[model samples]
Target: MQKIKSIFKTTGTKNGTYSVGLTVIVIAIVVVANLIFGQIPEKYKNIDVSSTKIYDITDTSKELLKNLDQKVTFTVLAEKAGADDRIKTFLSKYSSLSKNIKVEWIDPVLHPSALSEYDTSANTIVVACDDTGKSTTVSFSDIIVMDTSSYYYTGNATESEFDGEGQLTSAVNYVVSDSNKNIYRTTGHGEATLSSSVSELMTKNNYKVNELNLVMDTSIPEECDLLLMYAPSKDLTEDEKTAVEDYLAKGGKVMILLGETSSADLPNIASVMKEYGMETEDGYIADPSRCYQGNYYYIFPELSVSGDMAKGITSQMVLLTNAHGMNLVDPARDTITTSPFMTTSENAYAVTEEAQKQGAYTLGAVAEETISGDSAGKTDADTSENDGESDDAEQEEQKTGRLTVISAGSLIDSQITDTFTQLENTTLFMNAVSSNFDGVQNISIEAKSLGTEYNTVQHAGLFSLLVIFGIPLLILISGFTVWYRRRKA
Candidate 1:
């Protein structure tokens, strides 16, 4: 009996020692793992699990952060107690994207003299870059958008969206950019001016908008990066046309939005577009199958998603009214390539004054011409003796000119864009203008509507199967292994 009791005591001591050693190893492993993970950035570890993904930034923002060279700081002027939680969460995620970003939450009461020169009030955000000494201030109303559309009837202003990401990203982009792209709109022809919303969008994308009268100026300015002929009712003058032709010869960009007029009415303007293989028809397009309500003229055209114009445009539907049918003067050209980005279906037809024509038509198209060699503008006979010179000139003369033509003027109207909040008419126009600049990215992120249920994942077949079947199968295998080991023992 004494020997058996001693054996039991020895066994108990060994078991207790093994248990303590195992516990210590587990605790050490956990501590080391936590320390390793703590060193990583918060963006990689913290997943946005919110239903609306309020804290998650889009791929557009990610691309901007990847190319960020200068350090940008966002200074929020609000006390910690009174700060908006949505803004705080977004800024945290934004800062974690790059080491060049820093966010500071400064209360005006505590730091009375800090940033006194800026016109900042409570809840205003100042995004500044010390390298360039440039700063942009975002007001409280810009961050948190309010919808007063219903207030006129209900007498209560409701919250529309938290657009903190859009505002802050645009602000950062403005201060970091080297210079703005100068866009000169043609005036003195009864052309429509850009809407306030469109003008503001242009400003955010670092485009300086100014008016230019071709008759008065006689030539496109040297500083003009893009020329805008926005739905001009009258044709260009003889000298004006020559000036435009010269600008294009030396590599210039032009965006032409045609009004509801025939090619015969604007002969000089038509001639300029004809050089790029784009011409407009007499009347509007009528798509009976792709229109809204019973109105066949208010057609929803098909979008070529593979085109550059479709980049960064999420919402697909665009409303275009009083649009002319587009035709290519030369469908195939070795020097100029013309492709339509927006077209109508086969069943659609154009309604003209003469008669209705049944055929598929183009509503928007882009024409690009690459002029190379010394004989670019010379005739075949003139270049017959200069083959060697042309071969050498090919290396030096590689200039490209682009012309973007949209069929409708109403596409940029304020009533269409402001009324149809769900449609992407404004975004489409913005993307078209932004495609000219090589490195510029258009920021047209919409404000997330408050109190709306967004079902992001519509189809989760694989996820459903894993949750329903995979978990129970693992449990069964674990239970069977434990039972088998105990029974054998």
Candidate 2:
């Protein structure tokens, strides 16, 4: 009986100990599992609800909002179905960040009245404001990609998934900023228009471009900040001359893009340049090695970068201008300092008329100066010019730069879009222009935007959120339930 009693007690103690040990083991396993897998919902049996990263405050939209000061409205003129998810997502992200940006959806089909007033198209955005009274339209193609390589819609029948959020953000930047500067480009006598790809790029970078026949209007508009003379085939009227002089006297900025006009022919303009610093030569600049498409056009020549205008943009760019030239001067005026913005390599030569007619010649150059006559940095009137008739070819001491001067009448050819990358040029040029100003703030000009660009992934076919979070969740639930049932039993 004693032995039996002892045996029974031993067995009871062992059973109790075994049960406690098993329960402890189960609890440990549950705790370890929770630590490894994280939380999961029940319905998503195969889903993994775990996330490796947390939501942060600083995103691309937020960074963009922080840079903007003016109130901007992004009016979406399409159905939600047509809207690019990336654009909407970016706008939504921007909306949550700052009160300065507001998004409104307008179905152009439903309201035909808006189409006329806003000139809006399908899947488009009209960025506008009541104060500036200026509005810019962005089409679906304007902000999105046409193809994966070399962006152009394949005969207007193809579209690519474009995360245009990044670029459109930059566009909104151009319109809303105070630097939407206007460079009134002279036309008539046949100058180029903003319709060209290069001009389009100029406009995109805070320049409100307009073809001006100052001869027609007599007065250069008060709103215009600068004037540009680009390959004008005709001479300016006396009134036009006075208009130009008056603008310069008022401390306005001017850029002359000259062509194959003779020295005597450009007397009025040459006289103005001579007052500042230099004069355009009678013959064309020629280089055999640098000639393009043949001898009439210059080819890859080493360009001179000696001024702010040239140095600012040439950080990483190779220019390819054709038949364009200029008469640049570095005047003694305290308000001006002209320098060679571009030049061909030393292996280059400025061929006179004899060589030009011989079917070989150098054809382009660039020139610019810091014209600070007043507090706002303006160009002074051509007050003192000798108009020297010095035809000395001994310009070995003459300093020129990458401010390209193309002798060819058409440096910016119609096929400019095919030959050059306008997007790249525009970005750097805009940066240069923004930096050129005396007192203004440009965010990109100052520094990089922010932390890592938070590009949101597409919400698509069941793999993204489901696989990442759903599957882990199911195992967690099943494990917990089995533990619970075993405990109950």
RMSD of each: 8.7, 15.4
Candidate number achieving the greatest lDDT relative to the actual structure: 1
Q: Write the per-residue lDDT of candidate 1 for residues 203-238, one digit (tens) a residue.
A: 767789999998788778889888998889988889
**TM-score per model over all chains:** 0.75, 0.54
Please tell me which predicted candidate would have the highest TM-score against the true structure: 1
Clashes of each: 0, 50
- For model 2, residues 1-489, the per-residue Cα lDDT tens digits are 999778757978789879999999999999999876655422122322213111122243356677667878888888876776645654554455567777799887787677777765677778876556667777766555454443343444334333344345556666666555776788775665433445544544556676687767878887776576766666777778777765665556566656556656757666666665655555555556655567634454444433333433433444344433344545645555555444554454445656533332222333344322331222233322323424342232232111223333333444442345321233333333443344432222111121233557676666666877888898899999999999999
**Model 2 misplaced regions, further than 4 Å:** 1-66, 69-82, 85-122, 126-137, 144-156, 159-167, 178-180, 214-218, 237-239, 262-264, 288-296, 300-315, 321-335, 353-411, 422-489
Residue 79 alpha-carbon offset, candidate 2, angstroms: 4.4
Q: List lDDT for all candidates, in order.
A: 0.80, 0.53
Candidate 1 TM-score, C-alpha based: 0.75
Q: Candidate 1: which stretches are off by over 4 Å?
A: 1-56, 117-122, 146-161, 305-307, 331-334, 372-397, 450-489
